[model samples]
Target: MRYIYSTLGKLSAEQLGMILPHEHVFVDLRTPDKPGYGQADTASVLALMVPQIEAIQALGVTALVECSTGGVGRRADLDLAVSLATNFPIVVPTGNYREPWIPAWVHSADEDELFNWMLAELTTEIEQTGFRAGWIKLSAGDDGITPLEARILRAATRAAVETDALIGSHTIRGSVVMDQLDIIEAQGGSPARFLSIHTQAEPDFALHRAIAARGAWIEYDNVGAVPVAESTDLILRALDAGLGEQLLISHDRGWYDPALPNGGVPKPYTVVSTELIPLLRARGVPEDTILQLFHRNPFRAFSRH
Candidate 1:
């Protein structure tokens, strides 16, 4: 079976290989009052990241999905640069119409204006810069989708309908899952066109199964060795429930410097490549199963297949 990847505006075919669907090259956050916290210098990011990118390539990781959001330090120019430099097929989202994260100027503007701005960004980046982002990304706080965010979601759905792009999102927990989907579906969107990230953290299988029943892919992107047995078991149980095709696993680890003023987890790739996958292998998870979870599943989940 061959694999295809689309994360940073490029799609390429390759032999069936591992693909980490949720990750970041070097993401930094710029919260208020922490002016120096998140700075995305392309030269520096590429310089520091070349080795890690090469390492992933050498390890047979054919592609990656970079989930950098607006306030979370997303830079399309940098993403395009890395894709070109590394020749890695990536899918970056043309986003930011979501509430609380859309540019502050959007509040004064109508939803249509805000959405049009986001569309412009995505299209400009794709057509002019040669970046080919295939997904639309949005994030929600613990409250699920806010009013403004709902507008963003609708706009994104409309955009996806036109472009045939997929939708991927960050919903905090199980309680809000249905509500999140409500907005998407209201706009004529469905689970098949969406990826619900961090499903393993939702507390039970019933909730995940409910989501899958609706046709969305439940993403286990943040799973890792940390947080102990709970995380590991969450994944194992999900697979055991016969929901493998509906799942996509990743370690959402790459964004923090404990040494820096702010603290956060390291990159997801480091945890998966260095520790967790090996641990799972040592624990006797078959290579083919692991391959399907980390590779084929994600491709099918995000691609318009």
Candidate 2:
């Protein structure tokens, strides 16, 4: 049996319906040095996020993977508030983002210390929120996995091994997918429970195929950010190569930026629900396959057995 640890509580994998594998209900991407950057008020964020979530729910989305990790304006409390408001399950993560975004304490902590910290967050509650993280989220640089990023990744793998939690990584330029996998395997982590996020950024179908062949998951998130045709083509190419079971799709959307007036341009969570799915169907992708992409794949990706 497998269950997904959500902000509200643990839910059976079957309970995850039409999940958005990657999304951010509350995130502040503004630079910290500048005023108004990363300054989203909780009240305002809740007000803005709930309705958007409700709208996605109206479209039959039952769960979401809030990929906002530490040092990237992850608001676990905000995620809880929105989940409660909309009666939706949200699976949040515990880990750190790439350099500069990562906090000093994380950078200074030794591997064992970091591993324990992540393990605690996965098994226990995070910062008194009483919400255990569902997965470990990590980020690497475009050039490659930096030393700090590697440390975080290795620690995350160890934590996953202990907790049986999933690990999702933000791969820049898709350059270090193999290296990341090598480290996870070296640390005794299961590649099947790992996800190479932002995979479409690389546009190398062979790379995507290679990663999927290793029993890891490939995420084609960035739906609205990239052109729909190109994104769909990449997905179709992967499916054609018989990697559908190991594939995941999402918009990577939703963010309430406080820097601009009225929280900047709102990236609605409906792109995958409204635009991408319909496009896939019209392109001759079977309905069951679409269901697998939206529902089954997410359940397997987030669940801990």
Candidate 3:
């Protein structure tokens, strides 16, 4: 059985094959543009996702924790709808507050509005589809959390606490870490439930360790795509510091563009099963250790409401 756990009653970490804790199967920045904002159709989006979905299944991934939030062109209902049809074990869609790299025209949905909408949608999803939401995604740009972002975090915390779902975030490189930590704690969120993406960009073992010490998970995602030596060295450093269990590894991959030569997403960019695990194994990291980072740690941290 896949290990089933929850943050606030929300489920994640089903006992199964490998899981990609944070990723996007389909995203089109063009959807939120003017003239097509609310009018963006689901068919177009699904068309972009189908090929990759097939690829994911082929790669032996039993679950994919999609981090796309509403108001950012990610349709939870549509994604769930498709997942139901495919009978995939899980395709967890995030709630709202998908800022950063947001389309300029996505103005109708602010944090508060998105939060409210998210609650309603979540309820509907549970009642109708029986889809267990494994986690929530919130974002803060390089500047740190704003008032609206705080409101969203508060709402997420409340919902998470109530639902037992884990909270995951995208904190861009720079000074946003403290902001994220503050908001999560202020909302009575346990440090264990927090996941901040891309900590390797700053490469501060001390800082990452501090967060892990606080019971939060710090992701070293997007590192697998770099030169193996450099990436392995960083992973080793984190591990030596006793932070592996707090780690969550991923390529953060799966997107295709006609312009890109491979017709796939870039670094931090590959199907979860394709390159990440193999690269780590080749680098001399034990398979058990890698599984703890990629499979066990994420499941334990993210599922603990």
Candidate 4:
């Protein structure tokens, strides 16, 4: 069954409502070798992040894609607790992050081993926590994908092909994304199932169109962090270029970081619901198109095909 797997349950797109395609509930960005990198008391994390999750629910945002992955401290079990407490859904990732933050074991692991790990996590459960991952979260370096990073990405790409799951990368450079797609295609993964996350980091909108042209998802996830006008201008330009179907927008916000005291300050996941949508409406973006972006596109992008 093709479905968007959530922490609570497997649901259809309509069941998910508006989705923050790229957001974090709890993240530990410290290097894996560091002390207490991805570990946190579930109760402590829930206490800090549940209210933030509730705040978004009030604004009609229902689910969010938890971008926390292996290198960056993904705790699907921790996120599942939050989903149960607030009756909210969280889509989790089953992949690794970029270099430097990547663990030594990952560097030593071979391509087939990495591929097997991801396939098992996607088909079975992550860390044997009784929760399956809904998609793949990956990242490439600013200049280019390293040899180790390329192996990991290649493994993720192959696993995504096998499971019919989506692959989203926190890629910095547009050129690197093109390289990543080449590797994915070589491994039999389609660009249609790939996502160029943090697409705004690449200042060239021409590259944005290029990504969309290749059939991958182009995500503008820094919505709340940047000026509303700047965000809208890019989004409107995307629509004008006839790339609406391949576009996504989000806050890239939230995250209860265990590394910080009291998990630091979490940004609210409300800008897209409260601000950007309204601005788009005022700019004559049709209601149907708005629904397509927040409602339909998320499901299409994340659902297991």
Candidate 5:
């Protein structure tokens, strides 16, 4: 039997209804270089985020995977609060962010120490929050996997294998997708449990085909930000190549930016159901195929069997 850990508690994978594979509930993307940025008040965040989640739930979305990790305003307690308020199950992650967002402590720690930290987050409660992470999140640069990022990736792979958790990597331009996979397999991690995020940014269909053939999952999650036609085209292309089982989709949306007046225009999470699904249907995508993308694939990718 397989199960997924939510901010609230454990849930069977089958119990996870229509899922948004990648999203951020409360993220402060502002950098240290810019002052007065990346500041989020918990009360303010919950005040705004709870209603957005409730709106998503009204659209029939039962669960969501919050990809915001350490170094990026990942408040597990806030996630739990929203989940409880909306009665929605949210699967939060544990790991480090990209090079720019990574903290100094991550650089000081050795690979073994990093692995232990991530392992503990998966196996136990995160930083006394009493909320265990459901999966591991990692990010690589556009040029390639940097040396430090490689250490994090290797450590994340080891932790994922030990915890039977999925490893979702943010691969900009999809340049290092294969390299990440190589490292994971080298460290005894299963490629089937690895997810290559932001694949739509990479235009190489052949490369996408190769990655899917290797038993890794491909995610085209920039829905609202990217043109719907282009996003759906990529999904259809992958499905045509018989990679539907390994494909995942989401808006990659949501952010309560404190910089902007009134939270910097919070993007709605309903685009997947309201806009994308209708577009896919208009393009002749069958209902069953759509369900597979929105439901079955996410369960298989995120569930620990």
Candidate 6:
């Protein structure tokens, strides 16, 4: 059986409701060395972000993927606090981001050290949050992955293969995602367990197909951030090309920023519910396909069998 790790616990596919495959609750983009980094009071974050979570719940989104990984100031403690408060399920990842965003320690650490850290987080806890990581989230430079980033990628993929966790990168370029898949395969990770996040940024539709053809999932995650027609078109085309099972969709819309006052009036996480689905139905996407996108795909993408 395939199952996913949520804040609620290890849950099978039948346990998950409509899912937002990629989103965030709290993210601090400031580099770790800076002041005000990783210092958001849980009370303040809960007060400001819980309502955003609940609103999505009212719309039937029972689970969300909190894509804030280490280099971007991932706050697993905050994620747990919110989950406990609302009784909602959140799946968080274990990995680091690309250069400059990556912490100083990564530059000096050997590949095994990096792999062991990620393995511990996957098998144990994240920063003492008592919550083991559920997925793998990382990023790459737009031009290409830096040496340190490539080293981290190798380590991450090894951990991913060991744990059967899904690995997604905040990589904007499709070619870089191709490079990442190569590194992952070199580490003996299944390409099907890989996800090319922010794939919309790569306008070359052929790259999307190419990555999917190699058994990697292609994510169009910025649903609410742009014109609905543009997002609708990309999705329709992918569906037309019969890549439904290889595709994942999300708002990428979250985020309670610690840097902002009251988390800076977060953007709504409702585009998928309010706009996209209805548009998809209008354009002839059947309910089963919607069900596959919202439920089955996320489970199969994130779960370990």
Question: Which whole-number lDDT from 0 to 100 does residue 79 have in model 1?
Answer: 65
Clashing pairs in 5: none
Query: lDDT of each prediction vs. the true structure?
Result: 0.66, 0.86, 0.61, 0.90, 0.85, 0.88
- After the best TM-score superposition of candidate 2, give how far the Cα of residue 39 lies from its true spot, in angstroms: 3.8
Global lDDT of model 4: 0.90
RMSD of each candidate relative to the true structure: 3.6, 1.6, 4.7, 1.0, 1.7, 1.0
TM-score for each candidate, following the candidate numbering:
0.83, 0.95, 0.77, 0.98, 0.95, 0.98
By summed lDDT, which 10 consecutive residues of candidate 3 come out lowest? 1-10
In model 1, how many backbone clashes occur?
16
Off by over 4 Å in 4: none
Measured on C-alpha atoms, candidate 5 has an lDDT of: 0.85
lDDT of 6 by residue, 1-305 (tens): 87788777788877777889899888888887888886788898888888889998899988999999987888888999999999998999999887788888888899999999999988887778777789889899999988888998889888988888899999999998999899888889889999999988998999999999999999999998899888999999999988999889999877788788877888888999999999999999999999998888988898884
Model 3 TM-score on a 0 to 1 scale: 0.77
Off by over 4 Å in 6: none
Q: Model 5: per-residue lDDT, tens digit, 196-237? A: 998887888888888888889999899999778878887788
The C-alpha stretches of model 1 lying farther than 4 A from their native spots are 1-9, 12-16, 31-38, 97-99, 114-128, 225-230, 255-268, 282-284
lDDT of 4 by residue, 1-305 (tens): 56898887688865777888999998888899999888888888988999999999899887899999988988889899999999998999988899888988888999999999999988888886787889999898998989988999889988987988999999988999999999998988899999999988998888988988889999999998998878999999999999999998999999799888888889999888889999999999999999999988998999985
Best by lDDT: 4
For candidate 2, the per-residue lDDT at 34 reads 51
Candidate 1 accuracy as lDDT: 0.66
- Whichever of 3 and 6 has more lDDT, that candidate is 6
Model 3 CA deviation exceeding 4 Å by range: 1-15, 30-33, 38-48, 98-132, 223-225, 256-272
Question: After TM-score superposition, what is the CA distance of residue 229 in candidate 4 from its true location, in Å?
Answer: 1.7
